[model samples]
Target: MIRIHEVTRRFGDTTALDAVSLDIAEGEFFALLGPSGCGKTTLLRVLAGFETPDSGTVTLDGRDLLALAPHRRPVNLMFQSYALFPHMTVERNIAYGLAREGLPRAEIRERVTEVLDTVGLTALARRRPQQLSGGQRQRVALARAIVKRPRLLLLDEPLSALDKQVRAEMQLELKRLQHEAGITFLVVTHDQEEAMSLADRIAVLDAGRVQQVDTPVELYRRPRGRFVAGFVGANNIFAGRLLASGGLDVPGVGVLPAAAGDAASGDITGLVAVRPENIRFADPDGDADAPLQGTVLDISFFGGSSRIAVTVPGLDRPVLLTAPGPAPVAPGARVALSWHPESAVLIEETVETTVETTHG
Candidate 1:
């Protein structure tokens, strides 16, 4: 297990990490998710013992990591660039650590063969880093890191360099390898879908602080604040003040459950956020409860699905709706939209929390 207790880091006047604390369980694939300059990389470096925290401490399996050097720590890092030696062949690169440890040539050859086979690179053992494809180079990096049998593994944006197809394949391969090795894998990534699909748990960080850390489904369904809902995906945010009664009245979207805010009527000041998929197009003459009428403004094709932009009266921003196959309405067409009561979450509205909580 890896423990991060009140870790804080500062570079000059900027604080890269602001008193963050987390625990990464053994054999778990823990992901650090955030945008660029959100301190994900800084946290990874701290875990790898390359960067020391200004406050608090990092411990691995009861050993104080702050007291050890990078090489002395039982951790290995796989850099985003794959950082393979351009001149060395794949086999030699994987065996370099063992060679430095003064292992016999025969032992090094056996271990190298096994690791190459494990990463599906046995046939390309003689190839240099420059000679292999992007995905293959990444595999070589993985082979190098696991050959040492480290207690914890750190990956810093390891898939950003690959093409989409290769990235998808490598993501599954990495997940499988981590499970087979039964080691704690800590990955730093900014991609929400990646974190959702591959992580046992995700820590969403932003501006050197933790926004929300939980399972993907929980984060999506029950966002603690408005920033998380908008950041995770396309959201239709309806702005309106709370009524004296416990009911939410959006001029365009209509009255929702004021109880969602936990504040009584006049005390509520937040907006209601609903996901694009939750908003359904309805007939204008449907029901009085379906008062969300809008004009179709634009449509976009996304191969697997499509998105429609609708501009409604009393709202400044267009609402994005996800529709299957093709859009049902053309531009300039008037449409009615409705959503289930449970689909939208009403969180407190503060620009500070919005800016601080969103990961990407």
Candidate 2:
């Protein structure tokens, strides 16, 4: 377990962490996710004792973690480069930590063997870093970090070096290893999908601040703010003012119904975010009339699903919708888009605030 309270770190004029606080449960697979310059890595470094916070408190299992030195802390950091010694064999690299601590040769060998088997690198134990593949070297690096059996493990973009297929495989592998090892994993990554797939809970950071912390399902389904809605997944955003009639009067587009409890009683202007998957194609001439109509501008096929971009009459940007299988209509075809009122999320617009929709 870990607790960070009002942690702030600054370098010159730049603030890396701005009074950030979080609680990580024991044996929890937690992820710190954000884009570059968002301070996810800085936060991880602070936790690892690599970087000290200007003011705050860090506690691990009720002990003062900030007071401990980097080596004395009950934690280990696995770098993105898989920093294994080139001259050392797999077993030697794994046992280096224990050896530095002056453990007996027999105990070091036993621990190294156990860790190699745990990471499924026993067969490659005799191979050097240069002699092994990237994945093998990564396992060696992991083995090295975990051989000490620290209470907490810090992984900085652990799977970023691998290709798509290998990254996917390692995602599951990391999850399995975490469970088997029963160590609390705190991973720092800019990849949203990776965090969602691997972490039990994720803390989304932006501009040195924590935007939202929640499970993958909760973050996707109930994003707290405009930035979170746009960042975590694909969402169609509409800027508008809330009307007293329980609907949002979006300029260009007509008023659309809002989810209950989203619209405030007084006059409030904000943005409405709707996931692409939540929108359905409807027939204009059918008995059930949809509120919005648009001309199909483009259709993109993505294996089992298709993305349709529609150009509405008054909307500035094309509305995007996702449907299963092939696209139902060609470009320039007229179509109606319908969505449930409950699916819409209201986001208040602020002068200094902007949403980053680019996926990590």
Candidate 3:
């Protein structure tokens, strides 16, 4: 288990981390997720003992982690570049750390062989880094990190260098390795999909502060703020004032039904966020009183789903809608859209926020 309390780090005029706090469960796969320059990597480095926090404390199982040096701490950092030695073979690369610790030759040999088997690199043990594929080299790097059996392993953009297909494969591989190794894994990633798929819980960081920390499902379904809602996935946001009748009232778009969560009274400023998949095309003849109407602006097909962008009358941006398979609606067709009242989330934050640096 690890506890990071009120950690702060600064770089000249910019604050890299500002009063960030988090608790990572033992042997849990946790992820620090955010955009570029959001301080996720800075926090990771602090945990790895590469960077010191200006204030606060870091503890591992009640031990003062900051008191130990980088090599003295029971932690290992796997860099993004893999940092493999070109001249050394895979076995030698993995054994380099154990050798540096002055372990016996037989023990180093045994540990290297076992780790090679764990990473499925036993067959290519004699091959150099140049002879290995990108994914294989990644395995080598992972093998080198895990062979030490540290209490925690820090991975910085672990899958950023791999191709899409390889990245997907390694995502599953990384999870399996973590479970098999029984080591706590703390991964820093800018990719939302990677964090969602690999981490049991994620901490969303922005501008040197922690915005929200929750399970992947909770973070996606019920975002605590506007930044979490927009950064986690594709959402249709409607900025308006909260009405007494449990809805959001826009100047031109009228009242949109939303679930008023804990907001007992109305007349407050808020926003309603809806996902594309939650919106449905209503039958114009049957449901004569559809609240929202728009013209289909464009449609894109992605094999399993079709994305339809509808041009609403008063909204600044087109409302995105997703449907299964090919939709029969054309570009110029008029359509009515509707979603369940509970499907919309009422964000009470009044400030305007832009998620320009977010990566999906």
Candidate 4:
């Protein structure tokens, strides 16, 4: 387990981590997800003792992690570059750390062989980094890291170097390795889908501050604020004020019904976000409960699914709808977008300023 409390790191005028705190449970696959310059990697470095925080403390299994040197800490960081010695064969690369630790030759060989088997690279152990494929090289790097048997493993974009197919393969591979190794994993990545698919829980970051931390399903379905709603996935956002009748009233659109927990009693103005998949296409002249009429702008196909963009009156951006199978409507056709009230998520308007303050 790892714990970070009020950790802050800054570089001149820019702050990389702003009083961020988090907990990683034992054997949990946790992910730090955000865009570039969001401090996810900086925070990972702080945990690894490669970077020091301006304030606050880091503890692993209740030990003061910051007090120990990088190598002394019970943790291993797998860098994005793989960082393998080009001339060293896979076996040597994996044995490098144990050898440096002055372990006996027999012990090193045994551990190296065991880890090579664990990572499914026993056959490639004789090959050097240059002779192996990118995925094999990555396995070499991972085998090298895990051979030391650290209590925690830090992965910094571990799959970033692999091709798309290989990356997808390694995503599942990484999870299997973690389960087999029984070491807690804290991975840092900017790819949302990667985090969603690989991590048990994710901490979404932005502008040097923690935005939201939850399961991928929870974060996607019930985003706490506008930034989260916008960043986690594609959403159609409408600015409006909350009405007493359990709905949101917008200047351009009528009072739209709110999702279960979205409605509040007083006068509150905010943005209402609806996922594209939640919206359905209907005939403009049909007798639906409530529909927003719009002109179909375009349709895009993605194998099994399709996305339709609709231009509605009084809205600056087009509304997007995701549906299965072929295109439902062609461009320049009039359509209506409909969804259940439970599909909408209301995000308070002041969340932007609050996020700004925390990030600053």
Candidate 5:
């Protein structure tokens, strides 16, 4: 297990990580996910002992990692580039760490052989870096890092270099390898699908802060606010206002009958976020609560699913809706869009702090 307590890091005047803290459970495939410059990698590097925090401590299994040197800590970082030694063969590259630790030749050979097999690189142990493909080199990098059997493994964009097919294969391989090794893994990735598919739980980071940390399902289904909803996936929004009570008053999507969350009675301005898949296309005349009756402006086909862009009156932006199957809707067709109030989420426009009068 690893715990980061109020960790902050700065380079020059810009803060890279700001009081970010989270606990990573042992054997959990934890992912620090965010877009570029969001400080996910900084947090990983802090955990790996490569980068120290300006404040607070990094602890692994209750031991203070801040006091330990990078090489001294029981952790290994697999770089994005697959940082394998080009001059050394796969076996030697993997054995390099063990050799530095002054292990006996027989023990090194045993570890090298064991890890190569673990990474499914046994047959290619004699090949050099240039002789192997990207995926093989990745396995070599993994084998080399895990040869020591460190208590924690840090993977920095481990599959970024691979093509789509190879990346998917490696994702499955990584998950299986984690179970086999039974060591904690902290992966930093910007790819949303990768984080959703690979992580046991994700810590969504943004601009030096953690926005939300939860399982992929929780993140998608129950996003807390504007950023989480928009960042996680495509969401259709209906700009409206809340009435004096807990009722919705949309100019176009009218009184979204069921109230959502804790939208205060007097707050007249708000937005509704509904996942594209949640919005179903229905016959306008058939349903009474026709929130959006629109002309289909654009339609895109993706074999399995299709996206229908609907243009509703009073809304400036087009609403994107996703439906399963090859036949969703055609462009320029009229459609009715409806959603259960409970299925949609009402969010404050942003995460900004509003001044509240907490009684003098």
Candidate 6:
């Protein structure tokens, strides 16, 4: 229900947003994800009317949203700090906005009561913010924002303050709350896990531009560009030239398996991206001409899986492999790595700059 068209914002010589455009469907849970200073929060502020763009337009339901005042706009921004009143009780804090808007006393009471129950804070409605935990305070902030029944809700790092355990719980809570409220939710977060778990669709931003916008699965499986591939998840990217047979020719790694659809005929150079989970340990008796053979550098075990780092002959960095359950091979063991041709995604680079490689 929201369309942001070519929005550009600048602070002095630094451009915060550069011709950024996005479409958020009605009742859709969307996320603006990027690292620090990638312009995600700036874009969110532009949508909420807190920051005016130097150029471009914003529309909500086909109406010009920029023309409306912050308070007049049918949108609410929940700050990262939660911004709850320390002195006021939960119900009173939630009802503050409605009271200021001159809503009827009875209507305010009804709305606050309903929202308190919706957020499962009915029993603690009379408790002060200091009395509540971080997660509870977040719910109160959410309750306050939704009490207005906004057409859109903008959340800025909504779960950053909570511990890892509480953060996970609140992630599920946030998704459930958004679904129940039927509001268009646009959350800004640098946490990839948060965005992937809570948002139906995510827009990955980098250098003040949108790298790609897609569902969590597509963003993980088929990243359209180098930044998206490198940022969204753990990917082993090989810089190489594309062969006529639809394979990537890495200088020292030899020809790695890739899909022909990654590039048309005559394309010279591209990137081959493979996820660790997609790579497997080839049997010792398997093809000796395997594309990659490495010495297992080290292995770290998580509860459900193991991560093995393999030092290849010609690669500057070790190739990572994820095995289920336990370490399949001991450290310093010779292992052959293989993956399906279709598992490798070809990313045709459009820029000369390089993305920082991530090690799992």
**Model 1 Cα displacement at 159 (Å)?**
0.6
- For 12-110, candidate 6 gives per-residue lDDT tens digits of 999999999999999999999999999999999998899999999999989999999999999999999998999999999999999999999999999
Candidate 5 per-residue lDDT, tens place, 256-293, comes to 53364344545556655778787788788888667668
Clash number for each model = 0, 0, 0, 0, 0, 0
Ten-residue stretch with the least lDDT total in model 1? 351-360
Q: Itemize residue pairs with steric clashes in candidate 5.
A: none
Off by over 4 Å in 5: 242-247, 257-269, 349-360
- Model 2 lDDT, full chain set: 0.85
The whole-model lDDT of each prediction reads 0.81, 0.85, 0.88, 0.85, 0.81, 0.88
Go through the candidates in order and give the C-alpha RMSD of each one to the true structure: 3.1, 2.6, 2.6, 3.4, 4.8, 2.1
Candidate 2 deviant stretches above 4 angstroms: 243-245, 261-268, 349-360
TM-score of candidate 1 against the unseen true structure: 0.91
C-alpha-based local distance difference test score of model 5: 0.81
- By lDDT, the better pick of 2 and 3 is 3
lDDT assessment of candidate 1: 0.81
| Residue 331 displacement in candidate 3 (angstroms) | 2.1
After superposition, the stretches of candidate 4 with alpha carbons farther than 4 Å from their true spots are 260-264, 349-360
The stretch of ten residues in a row with the least summed lDDT in candidate 6 is 351-360
Please tell me which predicted candidate would have the highest TM-score against the true structure.
Answer: 6
Where model 3 places Cα greater than 4 Å from the true spot, the runs are 260-264, 351-360
Q: Write the per-residue lDDT of candidate 3 for residues 46-91, one digit (tens) a residue.
A: 9888899999999999999999999999999999999999999999
lDDT of 4 by residue, 180-296 (tens): 999999999988889999999999999989999999999989888877877887887777665545666667666666643334456566777889999887666765655588898
Let me know the TM-score candidate 6 reaches against the reference structure: 0.95
TM-score of each: 0.91, 0.93, 0.94, 0.94, 0.91, 0.95
Clashing residue pairs found in predicted model 4: none
